[model samples]
Target: MTDEAFKREVKTLYVAEAEDGIRLDRWFRRRWPHLSNIQVQKMARSGQIRVDGARIKPEGRLTAGAAVRVPPIPDAVVRAPGEHQALSPADVAFAKSLVIYEDDLVIALNKPWGLAVQGGTKTTRHVDRLLSAWGEGMERPRLVHRLDRDTSGVLLLGKGPEAAKRLAGAFARRQAKKTYWALVIGLPKPTAGQIDLPLKKTGINDFEIMRPADAKEHGAEPAETAYALISHAGQRASWLALRPFTGRTHQLRAHMKAIGHPILGDTKYGDAVSAELSGPLKLQLHARRIELDHPSGGKLIVEAPLSPEMRAGFQHFGFEEAEADADPFAGVRRMR
Candidate 1:
């Protein structure tokens, strides 16, 4: 990739403007005033700038409005031999836009509504795979936890082995805290209460593995939870802040279904009460906040704002004027 040592510049260059033939780097200098020639020089040294799929010297002159392709600037990624197979720089850039917070060890992203974390037999191009390509040279960051493909926001990834193990332990021991912002049909009657339901994942049903609340008296792991009413009354749907003390597979989804209110877009869990479901939303679940101990020392608290879609839905329900980061449960901590 460093073929442009001497000619450190671009090859297949195109500029759409009507400027005269100016030195390539000089033209770039004027265009991107923030970048210095030295920075441009470094880019040329990397053989990243191409004229027409060819590397050119930095001094090469450019025709006006010519298309110039600059090799993407590398972030703090660990480059590998060929670990980047199907992914492109554009894909990586898009994924980075989803990030809400990041440190050396982890990244918090706003996952869109319809993507999976890990692929099944037929599923491909998951967020996990995309992120795997990001930490390329590094240990290829893996999901420390998972959010339903349809759920959005505050998703976390462990940058390396130590961080990964520490994060996993935090979750297992309930040291990590996850708070979800959800839109459910009808207000929870009590307004605020805990649902200490036991959740299990058995082949229980082909439709879904979630155990029903009526039959929830079987042998299963005890699931503790706390929730508060964000706002409820006239709106057919109510906004809730959900905190699941234990991370169980589909724990929130199943538990919500077990109670009277299933999430808006949960077809699997809402089948029986599907009639209660209304509105254009499919799954109104958002991973609003995640707090965990950083691998290095200090604590980390990452919060994701509501997605555009969810925000619009909230506006439709006349609750668009909600509080931002209104954590009534703020300052709460768990001992590891």
Candidate 2:
């Protein structure tokens, strides 16, 4: 575009609390996806993109309340509130098939194992795309958070932008509580204890993994998980309940590995710990339950049934789901 056009079309936006800490390029892609990565990088390099009135890199992390100057882009297609993509009837039906719970403001899915929450490189079918089929004239479905592709259960979505913003804020503020269930190779030493460890990312993109790190290490982020032993199969395997205080990339998986009790079927972090186990192995981590204040009113609590693989594993280990406590983290104190 010409400089005059760029000058006329340029805009400034403030980062919301829910958008805090995301990469600057990600913020642009979320809002103006037609602005390609190449375009964004060039714009940033040329000082056409600035944060708080100063030039910033595309990969720079954004802070809450920071103002960003966005340059006009060719072929930019920004959607206004209530606008959404159209989906086929088959997609709509597929989206409805996963619904475990929903209300006027929220929709919760019992996301199956191996299904991705968002689309990525070569990821055509995902919860985000399916959401477009969640019917029309509903102010566009929005995901409040994410679950790993291999992880199953309790994937939450908002019916509209307002609801999404509120739900995302609750998560960012640590007000949303999530409980996970995992079948591990062996029992935790104390039976129940907190996995207090700092973590940092290693590798990149699809190959990325989290690793325990010193608190003083650069790029290290605090990660804590309060775990409780629910059931055990002697020294062979154990069913554990996990409550993560801080959400980091692969935090639960890395922490479990750091403690020498990796979740079963997690080949990436488990290091073939389940190699000797009989029968087929699948990632044994499940987001069993979640609790948070509803966008409308009152508390919103939902629980997902165990996945098919988890059921089979439970049967194999003779672990009954009912044996788990009503509130698995009831005795675990909340981290300040």
Top TM-score prediction, candidate number: 2
Task: Point out where model 2 deviates above 4 Å.
Answer: 1-20, 26-38, 41-57, 63-86, 136-138
Candidate 1 accuracy as TM-score = 0.68
Q: How many times do residue backbones clash in model 2? A: 0
**Candidate 2: Cα lDDT at 130:** 80
Position 126, candidate 2: lDDT = 75
TM-score of each: 0.68, 0.82
Which residue ranges in model 1 land beyond 4 Å of their true spot? Answer: 1-84, 135-139, 204-206, 213-219, 233-235, 271-277, 330-336
* lDDT digits (tens) for residues 1-336 of candidate 2: 333443366655455443557798887786555668998899999999998789888899986546577776565365433223356687778788888998889989999998887655445577876875664334457777778889998988877656876776677777788999999988789998898899988886578888989999987888888999999999999999998887777888899989999888887887655656634868889999999999988999999999997887798899998898878787567665
Error of 2 at 121 (Å): 1.4
TM-score of 2: 0.82
The C-alpha lDDT values of all candidates are: 0.65, 0.79
lDDT of 1 by residue, 1-336 (tens): 332231243222234222224477865664344456787887776676766456767888764333466654332144333333556788778888888877788877888878886544334567856874464434467566677777888877777656765665566556777889887777787977778877656663234465744334553655666777787646467888888876666778888777788777676676545435544666778888887788787788888888876776677666653553557567543321
